[model samples]
Target: IVYSWLFWYHSQLLTMKTEASVLVEVLDINDNSPVFENHPATVPVPEDHTVGDEVTSVNATDADSGFNGEVRYTLLGSAGRFSVDQETGVITLAAPLDRETQDEYRLVITAQDQGRPSHSATTTLDISVTDINDNAPIFSKQQYEATVSEHAEVRTNIIDIMATDKDDGENAIVTYHIVKQEPSSTPLAFTIDEESAH
Candidate 1:
């Protein structure tokens, strides 16, 4: 801005006069929008991970100064399973997760400034739920019954029992064991195949 004015000074014995113009500049405006930089597109979390654990972080920046440059973080579709720090942009787990029930989650993270007409930006986040050995193996049948003659051979096919687990990888692998029998026998009445459960 420029201003024009006239100034004069007079002394009792002498007279002097001066005139001058002045210019001023102003900076800073709420014109910049928040921008997300180098944030991950996808993240993986374990199903057995404890609640309130750190999942990941997001960052954003603005070119404006003061309150317009200050960014706040938020999660748009966390579904009560995740949360984000307003000032730090750190994401944390908010609830227990089960991969069997929900394998993945799609969310949007938002960054906004404090300007009068807040400027904001959004980023997509894909959170994949990794498998864990949290589910126990369940037997298809409660019990198995088989009858054999006293003169049966040493190796004989018996009733097959099966159990299933909802977990993945080695966690889903099921094996069989003969813990006990109804009546005690001198050399054990029957045997089972651990692999086939025969």
Candidate 2:
């Protein structure tokens, strides 16, 4: 009986070979926030730009993969003047722009990932509305009446003429000139300063 039991045990040990062990690693979850790349902090746009025109584009990226890496854009405090593409991040003018009314616009752009708990990042987009020569110079008085003595000098300082332009920069710069004199043949008696419009 002992000899038979020993042989059975030896057979069982030979049958039970070495078992192999396997290991697997689990990936990380979405933890990184969206980030913008090579985007301009400030953009200059003409005030006369038509509606629906493309103002600028922004780009962002997420480190996570699959749905977690998908990013959407949002414009905060746009006030219907501008719109942004959620997928493309392209910003367009939604309303007419007027530098006279509002010279600059401060926009906050946000990029949010499509993860379960969305991660977002923000950037400041400063849009400066450039001036346009849309407004014409207007004189304060419709008509001018001045009295000059006959003995007045040729270079005597005449009444100071004032004109104002609503536009900005060079568009608003006013220059005084005598387009038409009282008498066509009369010599250039009066001269005004171009800079001061006097």
Kindly give the stretch of ten consecutive residues in candidate 1 with the minimal lDDT sum. Answer: 1-10
lDDT of 2 by residue, 1-198 (tens): 012111222346566644444445456578989999887788999998889989999999999887888999999867688999999999999999888889888999999999889899998898999998999999999987789999997777768778899998888988887787665656666777887755
lDDT of 1: 0.86
Per-residue accuracy of model 1 over 39-158 as CA lDDT, tens digit each? 678899999888998999989999988898999998978789999999999999999998999988987999999998999999989999999888899988886677878877778765
lDDT scores in order: 0.86, 0.85
Candidate 2 Cα deviation (angstroms), residue 12:
16
Query: What are the runs in model 2 whose C-alpha is more than 4 Å off?
Result: 1-28, 188-191
How good is model 1 by TM-score? 0.78
lDDT of 1 at 99: 95
